[model samples]
Target: MNIKQSIAIIALLAATVWFWQTQPARPAPRVSFKTIKGANITPADLKGKPVLVTFWATDCPGCIEEIPHLIELHRQYSQAGLTIIAVAMHYDPPNHVLAMAEAKQLPYAVALDPSGSLAQNFGNVQLTPTTFLLDRNGRIVMQKVGVFDLRDMRQRLQAID
Candidate 1:
């Protein structure tokens, strides 16, 4: 092959490899944060329990829309060894977060990540209602970036225990 053709082929191969390597990795990011309830939670806490860590915001319609589903998921799966954590973002103040949790009658544990600590740790959180499903070992299994369908979520829960 001519030198020019050889170089072109090598460049093409390199680009292909780069693109393949840049794809998102399976198992979501790991982030640890304190719950608004003053509970110091870490990935370690989830080591023996299947954990659903959901990132949400009060202003996001999609996030608000999923509350009932989340509550239901917790109620349904609690006996099955599932832990549902609602991590509300946008530091709306501790009292406000508590009040909202109370108003919603949120069945699962709820926390406010006002400092963005959890979100930043989770990586690339560009939308509300980002949900991470972690296995009993605290390893991320699924990362859903938008609203989750209840039926699909229920099925995923079933896969846990």
Candidate 2:
């Protein structure tokens, strides 16, 4: 090949690599855990329904602040095929999580990630209130790192419905 053609091919390859690297991350990773309610929760179980997976810690004020909204969302969309799973961080005491779950009367499934495996699967979640919204096909449509916008989340859930 000519020198000019070789350079052109190299340029194309560089562009391709850049594009690939800059692409957004894939949807939620596939993993399963048993909820505190003694039920197994997994991506497959949530198929055909929109799901909101939230990682939280009992000591996190922001996480605590979002509980009511989450409860409301659960009540509002569960019948419309929305599933909400709150996973407590590994550092959180299981008893504390259970007590909180009971005291709050949480309406949805609550799981304790004592191994943090579930959090790592969802991008090494190290912050409380980290959340992922997945569509009916199990593809993550949104990922919030901190406190999320309740109105915005509601709208997104409605869109999937």
- Over 1-161, each residue of candidate 1 has an lDDT whose tens digit, in order, gives 99999999999988875564344435545566677667877766666888888888777789889999988888888987898888887655677678888899887888777778778878756578888887776667777777988998788777867
Question: What is the C-alpha lDDT profile of model 2 across 1-161, one tens digit per residue?
Answer: 99999999999988885564344546668888789989998667887999999999999999999999999999989999888999999999999999999999999999989889999888788888888888888888787767888999999888887
Residue 122 lDDT in model 1?
80
Best-fitting candidate, scored by TM-score: 2
lDDT of 1 at 26: 55
Worst 10-residue lDDT window for candidate 2 reads: 17-26
TM of each candidate vs. truth: 0.76, 0.83
The C-alpha stretches of model 1 lying farther than 4 A from their native spots are 1-31
**What do the candidate models score in CA lDDT, each in turn?**
0.78, 0.88
RMSD of each: 7.9, 9.0
